[model samples]
Target: MGKITGFMEYERLEEGYRPVEERVKHYKEFVVGLTDEQAKIQGARCMDCGTPFCNNGCPINNIIPDFNDLVYRQDWESAIAVLHSTNNFPEFTGRICPAPCEAACTLNVNDDPVGIKSIEHAIIDKAWAEGWVRPQPARIKTGKRVAIVGSGPAGLAAAQQLARAGHDVTVFEKNNRIGGLLRYGIPDFKMEKWLIDRRVEQMQAEGVTFRTGVMVGALPSEGPAAKVTNDAKETVSPEQLLAEFDAVLLAGGAEQSRDLPVPGRELDGIHFAMEFLPQQNKVNAGDKIKKQIRADGKHVIVIGGGDTGSDCVGTSNRHGAASVTQFEVMPMPPAQENKALTWPYWPIKLRTSSSHEEGCQREFAISTKAFIGHKGKVTGLKTVQVEFKDGKLVEIPGTEKEWKADLVLLAMGFTNPVPTVLEAFGVEKDARGNAKATTDFIGGYATNVPKVFAAGDMRRGQSLVVWAIREGRQAARAVDEFLMGFSDLPR
Candidate 1:
């Protein structure tokens, strides 16, 4: 440990955020990163716990202690190296990732956990500023073509790894831009699109070819609708993709957003979070959208009390909505977790995000019974309060109610990847409908179809960006091993 008694000697330093009024006016990141000294102090807080659970707690299993030590020593370059050794995109995780590592810190047993996320954010930002981050183009060419379907974190990570391994990697994104959800579903206010563009530039230098606005394999043009990329300029059949590339990786994420099947779902003002979110991102990227969803002067009701719902709240506030109300079907968690009972793992506790702090009414243990409308448009919603009794949610006897809502955004998470893409490739699907691929120590991540693989949400269903990165990196290693008979890439 760089500082033997640092944990006892120093307190955790929190990151700063821009004033809400100032930040809400525009869609851009407002987090002010820790200073070098503050980062060193935060790093020093990493104690010499016998076992570094923080490392394992991370989805990517980042070398947390080593990077913490390096940052404490003021070796910023070495710190970034240690950080990047496991995390392909610290910039992404450092910003949006819920720091499970911090939750697992030994100090968190009683004291404030080491500010690992803030230190990570500081290290990466410093690396970029000092020109320490650069492209590591392959030293040798393998001449093997790998096709990556989707350009989200999983696809991007896999593409970068494979390309650096000297394989010819081509990433196909159905959207007009390279990043899938990162460039669209996520609000620029949380993380600006430039961060994605920066990584894309580096990936390009590493010999990864990006083919945006291209959909590989057939997709349904109608139905409840899934993975609708209105800007896909061209379509490549499954046969063409399989024949052209030596290997194909299905990295497209879970795009089938779970819907509210209640009546009045067909109302004009109701939309999936995916539908509303992408439009804002498109507009942020200078695309003038027709019939764009607007919350201005409208009472916006966001369902699903998760990160996506919080994002909707922020976006709606920025649009000057008359009011914002969020609903969660489950009972509200305690504001603080019982740490003694939930140490070394993610805790179940209430979390109020920065967007939630801006303004919004949050309703817990509430369920939407039906959407009420007149003249073929939504005007309000019928609701009921729910309670858990004997492990079952039963509506209370007399809590039925109705609330006015001019706009409704459903953010109840995704069900699975679009079926057409997997179906066209003849890949087997799991019971959950994700691409079926085991994470075995050997011959893993391979799909039923020969030379085809799947990773991230495409294989594991809806998950965090950090998990996606982990799957992508591991899948790349598996693909490399299958191709070159061995792989130096880390797990």
Candidate 2:
């Protein structure tokens, strides 16, 4: 520990946010990262606790104490090195991750947790500014080729690791861009796209090949999968990849968004959050979309209380929606969690995102029963108040009501990967429809099909980007071992 008593002397400092009025006018990151001195102070707050729970709390198991100590010592270079040791993209997680590590911080038991996330943001930004980030090309070539499907965080992480391990890695993306969900699913206001571009450039320099607009295997042209944004110009059969590459890794995301089967769902102006989100992302990237989903002067109703729904609220507000309201079927969590009961673990508590601060009416314990419309267009929706009784979600009598809404965005989260993609490769699926695979040490990430592996959302369902990176790194080792009978790569 750099300063043993620093935790008791220093107060926690959070990163600042741009004013709501100023930031809502455009789609760009609004967070103001900590200055060097502030970051140093935050790092000093990392106490000499016997065990660092923050490590396990972090999906990638970053060496938090070491980085915190390095930062406290003003070793910016070492801080970034420790950060990059586990996380391939701190810029992505530092910006968008929910910071579960902070929740598990020892200081959080009684006082504010160390501003670990802000410190991480500052470290990475400094690293990039100082040109500390560079491609590390392997000195020796393994001669083994690997094909990874989907260019999201998982696939990108695996590709980078495989390339660094001297294996020829090629990533296939169905979208026209290299970053699958990161390019389209996320809003630019949260993280700019240039970050992904620079990483792609670095990966290319490291001998990783990116094939964009190429769909490996096949996806359904209709139904839930079709709702996901895809701009494939070519289709590569599963057999071709299996034959051409020594190993195949399925790292695509869970693209099948959960749907509401209520009446009037087919009415105009109703769309999945994916359908509405990607269009704005494409538009932000300078692509002109036809009949883009606009919320200007319309009452927008966003269903599901999660990050995706919050993003919809922000985007709708940016489009000058007359009013934006978010709905959650589950009851609202407590404003704060009881630390004594939930220490060293993620806790359930009410979270107010920057989007909520901009403008939004939040509704909890409400479920949409049916859509109300006129002349084939949505006008409103019918909802009922619900409560959990005897472990059942039962609707309360006489609690039915109608709410005005010109547009409805369903953001209830994704169920699993598009079934067609897995089926096309003759891959078996778990009960949840994700690619069936295990995380065992002997043959982790390997699917039921020979020479085929799965990771990230495609194998584990919807999760955080950090988890995707972890799975990708581990799966890469598994694949490497399968190829060379052993792997020197870190787990």
Candidate 3:
């Protein structure tokens, strides 16, 4: 909290973006973060609401108010310290997270919430620019080895935490590079890969080893799971990891894409969003891709209207598609939320992303019926208007329609971690097909197999990146406690 009257004086300031026309021409980050003075103004708007719901709303429980106050006081160094205390990687969350913390801001009941995410972005960027983000290498080594399966946020967080605790940590990634979904699945225009690179360098100096192109367990050789990006040149069995490391944490993400198995599913030019997104990312990194997917001059239909779908729209636009259309099965939400009915909680309301502003047709309450194709290639698709009745979606009669398309990208979310990876460790899966692990303090993140643990999307289903970081940090404490009688790591 800063000035008591600041909330009434300052309107929330939004971070700016490069113009749509110019931004679409390149795969560089377009966000123009706030200046120091602007950040201080935003930070001053944080009112001491007695109880900060924003903290609890944040998945990692970042000390939002403290950082806000520090930023207001121009204590940039201390601000980063407070931010880093809870979140291992503020840069990632600051850019891509949906910022549910803002939704829970007390002022959000009547006005715009404090620009918490923008402040965070400013703090971290300033810290890096000032060379304040240095490696915290442990003075003494624990002599214990920890193996983390995955190089995503969860694995990265755990590896960094465990390394700081003096444990010898190794993170295995099946991809050719680090930063799992952050490296591949996310569009480069939203967040450049360099941010991840610098963090990886810091972790390396802290004694965390990263082994890319190495698979922890066998991936499925066929089907949807197989489509998940894998550049593994070397394979290590679960038993090998168990024998070599004192503790093994499976932090692999849910990689199995939810498929649309209607008629003509096998037609060419139909691809999963993951398939299309990653290739562009790889190409941006200067990697040569054979037969890379492109949307130039093609009418594209993107199914699923979540963040992934929005990303598809943006990327398709960047590819200079003739047209872009997105479909969401659920009915459109109201333009504004009834704050009294749903406040201090994430509400269901209409959300238009920056990508939507870039240009695209968004269709709500629509369901794809089948793909239309000729000569073994997808040319268009058929759809029907649907409405929920008795908790079931029913297609309306005479609402059927067909649309032409050259490419159809399925942006439906992921269902679960690849079954083969879980099966390899003999890990039990919950009803949702995620690793069975309770978050109870005693043995949270521990798998059924002795000394084996799981977290992130591998344990929970598809979720935000901040949640993954939280699970990873908590799991680090649990593993440290298991290794020693007690752990100094924060919960």
Tens-place lDDT per residue, model 1, 26-56, is: 9989999998888888888889998999988
* TM-score winner, 1 or 2: 2
Cα-based lDDT at residue 300, candidate 2: 100
Encode model 3's per-residue lDDT on 1-491: one tens digit a residue.
Answer: 97788999999999999999999898899999999999999999999899999999999999999999999999999999999999999999999999999999998989999999999999999999999999999998989999999999999999999999999999999999999987888999888999999999999999999999998778888888989889999999999999999999999888899999999999999999999999999999999999999999999999999999999999999999999999999999999999999989999999999899999999999999999999999999999999999999999999999999999999999999899989999999999999999999999999899999999999998998999999999999999999987899999
lDDT of 1 at 354: 94
What's the alpha carbon RMSD for model 2?
0.7
What residue pairs are clashing in model 2? none
lDDT of each: 0.92, 0.94, 0.94
Candidate with better lDDT, 2 vs 3: 3
* TM-score of every model versus the real structure: 0.99, 0.99, 0.99
Kindly report which residue pairs in candidate 1 clash with one another. none
For candidate 3, the 10 contiguous residues with the lowest summed lDDT are 215-224
Candidate 3: stretches off by over 4 Å: none
- Candidate 1, superposed: residue stretches over 4 Å from native: none
State the lDDT of candidate 2 residue by residue for 1-491, as single tens digits: 55799999999998999999999999999999999988999899999988899999999998988999999999999999999999999999999999999998888989999888998899999999999999999999999999999999999999999999999999999988888888788999999999999999999999999998898877787877888888889999999999899999999998899999999999999999999999999999898899999999999999999999999999999999999999999999999999999998999999999999999999999999999999999999999999999999999999999999999999999999989889999999999999999999999999989999999999999998989999999999999999999999878
**Clash count for each candidate, listed in order shown:** 0, 0, 0
Better of 1 and 3 by TM-score: 3
